[model samples]
Target: MTRLRMGMIGGGPGAFIGPVHRFAAELDREIELVAGVFSSDPGRSKAAAGAYRIDPARAYGSLAEMFTTERARADGIDFVAVVTPNHNHLPSARAALQAGLPVICDKPLTATLDEAHALAAVVRESGLPFAVTHTYSGYPLVREARARVAAGAVGTVRKVVVEYPQGWLAGEASGKQAEWRVDPARSGLGGCIGDIGVHAFQLAEFITGLEVTELLADLGAVVPGRALDDDCTVLLRFANGARGVLLASQIEVGELNGLRIRLYGDRGGLLWRQEQPNTLTLHTLDGRTEIVHAGGPQLGPDALSRTRTPTGHPEGYLEAFANLYRDFAAVLRGEQAPLLPGIGTGLRGMAFIATAVEASRAKAGWVKLSV
Candidate 1:
């Protein structure tokens, strides 16, 4: 089969997730970055086309132009990747879907719940394969954990604890990533909550197969004079009488992407951590603990399918991200990618962000989550 072509929005020079999307989408040789309006500025967009090794003529100054010109070409992009900030997600993705192309968008769907609703409507109306990059769910072992939980490896999940801590923004925040994230207008109603908090929330539900029905939130801007939240702790109530706690913070002292989740049920528990992406620990009520490696034996079909190397090899963030892209490519080919996150994930993420931020703002005792 011919390789799929990708058009990117945002993630221009010095952008973090932009290059990440580029790297991951091409890692499996299933997709190629052929065109993009890398930056809103015409000059920067042209420069990025050269950096991406595509013809400068394909680099348009606006989303409209990119979609219009590309569709008129026989070699147009097969899909679009929206790697911009929270606000740009709706317009970029909407344009792609309206033009009869699929989309792979960054997390937090949109800057507001209303935008997510609008985008979700457009997605449903377009009838295309729309994916959202919730990165952790792409890990092989995390998929293993999900499979185990689903197959009754853990009986009746009762409690879940997920935490993501980063010290990068603990001090006075700077840099392109820091500046936009802390800005309310660009980052939406939250900073840390809309950013990594949604990741924790999404993973908790993704693995346990339960929905967060209600939450009590405590969000704060720990750094002095910061506008948006940098620290958040949310108490959760699940649909199946399960209780959960989601803690996402960018103001921790020495933590670096310290994302970990533990789920305990009547019979046993499952634990996975991002720092050690290859290992998943299974604990029993009798204190028996088993270590499950990424490429180890006895893994479920879903986990094994997502694995790249043999046992003892490492597959980190980029590989996890690539798993999504690879599976998405198959999806674009009309295959079922059960583990791939989609528009529903984006809708729930926006709900989670809006609900958590509003609850914290009002100090509401326990607000029901509508996701």
Candidate 2:
């Protein structure tokens, strides 16, 4: 099997998501990182690439130059991973795709709806697989939830309650992580909504197989000096007559990545939490509750395929993120059509962020998702 040679666009020194992406990409051994334009600063980029033991010639200062140089190499990169801030995703992705390489990007597809649309246009024109790492969608049990919902185990989805909260920014700012995330220019239109709320939105829709038709958003800034929202709550209306609520925050004191989703339907309901990803709670109308464990025989093939451990062991955030990369590598190798969440799911997330922001700005009015 030919290993996928990968290049990175960001994830220089002190960049958070970039290292996580590297870890995930390396886990399966099916992909190899050959080169990168890892930082905006040329010196920083050189230092970062050196730290990873990449060839200095392969570590260019800009994405365009990286694409050109890498393409000229006989062993060029098969794909590029875009790990920059919201504003840089579009330009870097376009540069790689135009050079005929597939792309895997981080979420909130672009900084604005217009940029996201333009990206979609390019993706359609390219015909190359573009994946967006909505990491939660990579969970094994989440895939099970999606399968069960699609199979009508939950007959006619009625309501979805997905909430994600953390206390990292409860009262005061912390590090560079908290700084860029709360800034309007770097984090995009909505803060908490764009940062984490969109994950909740994507989870609810992905699991229950229902599309949100409209949403009413209520966002807030719990910290004193922050410019953008650190907390948010949204009321959602699904196309299939299902009603829902989504809450996300970075300011819920003492709370970790406490993301939970509950979907209720005519036949039953299903519940899953991020902190305890191995077990999925299923509720039936007949008053029976069953716990679905990852890698068990009861799981569907899709869910089973994502699991790397036995039934009792645990697989959390990093594993989930790796699952996305593993599956994407499979698709890139012509093995499948992306059973895992990819560009389409990322586009949905961007739409969710745009809608929530518009709704919150419109005095908490309803916003339609046009993406």
Candidate 3:
């Protein structure tokens, strides 16, 4: 199959997630970055494109220019990756879709629930493939956990506990990433919930195949002079009669990307940690436990398809991120690919963020999800 051409928006100089997106998109060599508007500033956009060795002609000053110019070219981008900050996600994605290109976006879909719903409507009207990069869901072991739960290997999912904690924002800082995340105008209604909390929420749902029906949340701005929450905890009720607890914090004092999820069912239970992503622990009701490793015999075809290495070889964050790009590329190439989080997941995540904020303001009382 021919390599699919791709373009990017954002991930310019000193940006964290932009480079991660570049690495992940090219990891499997199935897609190539042929065009981009790397930043809002024209100079930085040109420089970033030069650094990536993209043709200067393909580097544009803005998303509008990029979409218009690329669509007119004989060799246009197959899809556009929206790696901008949360505030720009909706506009950039809408532009790409309106230009008749597919989109791969970072979560939580948009800066607000209203924008998310509008974007979702555009996606449905356009009938193009749209993927939301819920990075953890792309892990082979995570897929295994999902498949196992779906097959009743853990009986019926009864409870879920997911937490993502980081200490980077524990104190007052003035970095670009930290600044925008704490600004309500840029990051939307919920801060911590919109940032890492959505990932924890999505992981629980993705693994257990359950939808959150109601939730109560406590959101905190642990650092001084912060306008948005940096720590949050939520109690969730699922449609399948299961219950869940979610905690996402950037003020844990000594944590570093520590994301972990545990699911309990009637017959058994399972645990997975982002720090130790290659392994999953399965526990039986009789006090027996088994350690399942990635690229091992126990994984089903779905997990194996996403795994790249042998039993002992390791795969981590970048690989998981690439798996989403890989599946999107497969879909573009007319190959059957496993389901990836898309517009629906993105919409739900935004709804969760909005609902959590509302619930927190009401003294953490329970609130039903509007979506």
Q: Estimate the Cα RMSD of every predicted model relative to the unseen true structure.
A: 0.9, 1.3, 1.1
Candidate 1: misplaced stretches above 4 Å? none
- Across 1-371, the per-residue lDDT of candidate 2 in tens digits comes to 77889999989888898889988998989888889999999999988987777788888888878888888889999999999888888999998889999999998888888888889889999999999888998999999999999999879899899999988888667677777788888878878888889889988888987889899988887788778888998999999889999999988789999999999999999999999999999999999999999989999988998899999988899999999999889899888945666667777888888888777877868777778
**TM-score for each prediction?**
0.98, 0.97, 0.98
Preferred candidate (lDDT higher): 1 or 2: 1
Clashing pairs in 3: none
Instruction: State which candidate has the highest TM-score.
Output: 1
- By summed lDDT, which 10 consecutive residues of candidate 2 come out lowest? 337-346
Note the Cα lDDT for every prediction shown: 0.92, 0.88, 0.91
Better of 2 and 3 by TM-score: 3
lDDT of 2 at 289: 96
lDDT of 3 by residue, 1-371 (tens): 57899999988877889888888999999998999999899998888976778898887898889888887988989999999889999999999999899999999899999999999999999999999999999999999999999999789889999999999999886798888888888888878899999999999999998999999899988888889999998999999989999999999999999999999999999999999999999999999999999999879998999999999899999999999999999878777665689899999999999999888987858888878
